[model samples]
Target: MAIELAGRPHRVPEGSSLADLLAALGHAPQACATALNGDFVRREQRHATRLAEGDRVVLVQPIVGG
Candidate 1:
């Protein structure tokens, strides 16, 4: 299936979970915040949240400031 990840089109395996997508993209589950189709998905839910075709995923990482 194909999904819009951070505004770019990407393909993932069928029945892929958010955690799987993150692993495929080289992101650590604990290092970023994720939103699915404009709604926030908690960290613990990543493993259970299955992504569908055309779903929008946004990943944001925390930045340290002075």
Candidate 2:
């Protein structure tokens, strides 16, 4: 299946969860915030949040500031 990841098209295996995608991208689940189709998906829910075709996924990492 293909999904719009951070505004770019990306292919992923069928039945893939958000956590799976993060792993594939080498992102630690605790180090970023995720949104699906413009809605926020909590970290704890990533394992259960199944991704669908054409779904929009955004992952943002926090930055420390002075």
Task: Tell me the whole-model lDDT of each prediction, alpha carbons only.
Answer: 0.95, 0.97
| Pairs of colliding residues, candidate 2 | none
- Minimum summed lDDT over a 10-residue window in model 2 is located at 23-32
lDDT score, residue 8, model 2? Answer: 97
For each candidate, give its TM-score against the true structure.
Answer: 0.95, 0.96
Per residue, candidate 2 scores C-alpha lDDT tens digits across 1-66 of 999999999999999999999999999889999999999999999999999999999999999998
Residue-level lDDT tens digits of model 1 in 1-66: 999999999899999999999999898889999999999999999999999999999999999898
Off by over 4 Å in 1: none
